[model samples]
Target: MRFSVLSFLTSAAAVSAAVIPSSSSAPEKRGGSISVTPHDSYSSSIGVLGCKINTNRAAYWPSSPDCNNICVKVSANGRSVNLLKVDQSGGAHDISYDAWNYLSTGKNATEAPTAGGGLAATYEDVPMSECAHLLKDGKHLAFAAANSMNFITSCSANTWVGKNYALYNILNTQCTWGYDELCRMPDPSQGNQPICEHTLGLTVALKTCPVYNIAYPTGKLSIAV
Candidate 1:
């Protein structure tokens, strides 16, 4: 696998949070407001993590990745729905228009719902396996490598895989060759076939990718060819 020096630097430059291990504690049920957001090309397809999500389904953007690809059971307005965690909202739960409409009217609507404040709701994390039916075919829940800097970058997603083995091979090559270099994988959500050529700057290569152990949404999810 060929690795690009520039791509690694670009990914590293986008890094904001320090390289810390993902939390291992279980996610507890929480109450908050589920804001309604318009569905657009980006929201319907490319998420902040560069993953493709089915907006037509009960999809939502959580404030973080604690529920990434996990099934979240949300209750509001005397109605309940199971939402698939697909993107980052930076605020409280921001749900797709379809999800909000269903919660408000108890039925799916073709037109967008009337704009308003978030609906008061409570949500709890459920395993991804339970929500697998909601995801599109060829999509799967994948964990991020510990040093992947995924939280702050849009070039990669926990679940997005390169159409081919390009990105996977690049990471594997770097790991096998013991190259301590930062690298950017292709943004698959941007197009059907993309080249892995973006750049991220770094003088020294980061540590080897570690197998992250997380507790919630239990299962070993991996990025594959």
Candidate 2:
């Protein structure tokens, strides 16, 4: 389930709004409140199809991919710790257990904080080049797949046509035919069925067959003399 950094750069067609800056000067700092939560499976080490991240070094999950692999400087309780943005929190500045403990008490505790609460924090996105020592490879941040199952299945098929066909099937079944842009309408002339269009500049042949039945012997047969 390992993905190279190159794969991510190519597949991620749309760039997020929080683009990492190219210059060496400090980036604009964003301030927000942080909530401490218990570490999950992806707490310490990198998870399946996830970026190479060292969560032990004050890692925090941001709300979007824009912050992926970006080094963040978290300041709170008159203390500041530089942490990496490794995973998604669905909300801004979701600090990991160990990280929060370190930030508040100045001790990286194995257990959760007794007095759990939110902390006022300011996050500054440090450029990847500047934070090379913190990164795994010093340059690359392996982008995690949004949908690992779909990624694996499509990669296994290994064809643009196959991927498109799979996408069509998913859209046809899950999405509204007429309302959704990708979903196709059921053609009344073709038995009111939805079919893959050949307009994709490639010809695809689809086939169907009836189910086969198997019979078992009821009794031994005697041969005629």
Best by TM-score: 1
TM-scores for every predicted model: 0.45, 0.42
Candidate 1 structure quality by residue, lDDT tens digits, 145-196:
2223344243233322221111221222123212332233446776433232
Off by over 4 Å in 2: 1-40, 43-51, 58-62, 67-69, 111-115, 143-225
Error of 1 at 137 (Å): 2.1
Clashes of 1: 15
Clashing pairs in 2: none
Predicted model with the maximum lDDT:
1
Q: Would you list the C-alpha lDDT of every candidate in the order shown?
A: 0.38, 0.36
What is every candidate's alpha-carbon RMSD to the true fold? Answer: 14.5, 19.8
